[model samples]
Target: MSYVGRFAPSPSGPLHFGSLVAALGSYFQAKSQHGKWLVRMEDLDPPREMPGASDLILATLEAYHLHWDDEVIYQSQRHHYYQDQIEQWIASKEAYYCQCTRRQIKQSGGFYLGTCRDAALTPEQPCSVRFKVPTAIDHFIDQKHGRIAIPKALADEDFIIKRRDGLYAYNLAVVLDDIEQGVTEVVRGADLIEPTGRQINLYHAMKQPEVSYLHLPLALDEHGNKLSKQNHAPALNNEEPIETLLSAMTFLGFDIDAHITSANLDEIIAWGCQNWSLQQLPNSLASTARF
Candidate 1:
């Protein structure tokens, strides 16, 4: 089968240094393999989404020469698809509505203890649908981190699939979108490593094919926290696209000489795709580029 990769960025805010690293890493990986690369806007959570953030993100990607194939997909337009999958899961008895509050779970070791797994409650009382997690999940391999096993203590939590407000949860939306889009590989930051296992389990429950996962190291601020919209990280400057791309490439373990700084975006991308290697990436979480 032909390889298909994607960079699905949430439109909560503009692309920051961390988002740039993820985009460039996935872009080069696909380009190097001569595979198709696509982009998707994960704008499902309206409350967290910033106005015009999606358009600004696309413009930034274009400015950095990270063009995608086919029409970009928006999650907001695909609500029906997620609903269909949820209905199927419900029919199969693989999911159940839970009325457990945050305080209840917090008092029970921070993981949902299946408090409402068998509760016969109507949807009128504002309940979230949760997946019935299995007792044990087998180990799955990470391209960068190697074979990894998620302990039952962490994997046994009954996780939510649909929020109380009826919005599709991230795990459900992402898994369904990947299956629909034919994504063969997922490349993103290490912050999502644990979620990958959960998604893998969901894929198995849904009888969908498993996709390879590669989680790149996260970019951290001076305070040692990951750069993210929640942390108030500054957005990328569209005026200096090349500078941002080059900085991102360097963060991904690419060795670009000072002379290469004069190269255009296309030329830099060409070199990057040709020279991209997973082994060059640092395993340490502290790996970052100096701004």
Candidate 2:
């Protein structure tokens, strides 16, 4: 299959420097391999979404000259598809409804203790649906991090797929979307490393084709906190696309010494793609000024 990669960003806030790093990394990786790069709007969580954040993100990408192949996909428009997958899992007994409240789980530590696995409740009880995690260790080799073994404790934790409030969980939606979009490889931040195991289990349960994963180092703030909307990270400067793009290139481990004088975003990205190398990425996350 032709290499397919994506940059799926939530529209909860504007695109920050951290978000740009991820987008640029994935974009160059795909372009360098002569593959297709697509963008997907992960707007499933309505409660956290900003009013016009989706449009703003698209505008920001355009301003940066990071164009995507084909039309962008919005997750909110695929609710029925996710619901159908959930129903199939239920019919196959691979998923169960849980009536356990947040207080119960909090009291017993963070992981859900499978209290509702054998509960005598109907689907109409307003219960959240959870995937019955498998016992065997799910292992996958990270393109950058080498072989990874997910702990049994985490692997066995019965995680949620559909929330009690009727929102589709991120893990479920992401897995389904990747399979549907035929994503052969995933390029994302290391913050999502833990969730990769759960998603891999889901892929196995569904018997779907496995996709390779590369978790890039996260950009941090001077205080050591991950730069994010919650941390008040400033949005990308759409007006100064070259400066922002060059900064993102450096974050991805590119040497832009000669091309630092590049006049435009296109020239920078073109040169960056021509010289993109996964081996050049730093193994550890680093802090940068909050621009």
TM-score of each: 0.96, 0.96
Clashes of 1: 0
Q: Evaluate model 2: give its lDDT.
A: 0.87
Q: What tens-digit string does per-residue lDDT give for candidate 1 at 40-96?
A: 999989999999999999999998888999999999999999888877877777888
Expressed as tens digits, the lDDT of each residue in 1-291 for candidate 2 is 899999999999999989999998889889999999999999998889999999999999999889999889999999999999999988877888999989888898877888988774577878999998865446678898788777666777889999999999999999999999999999998888888888988888889977899988898988888989989888998887787777777777777767455556678778888899989998774556334
Q: Where does candidate 2 stray beyond 4 Å?
A: 136-138, 289-291
Please state the error at residue 45 of candidate 2 in Å: 0.9
In model 1, state the lDDT of residue 258: 78
What are the runs in model 1 whose C-alpha is more than 4 Å off? none
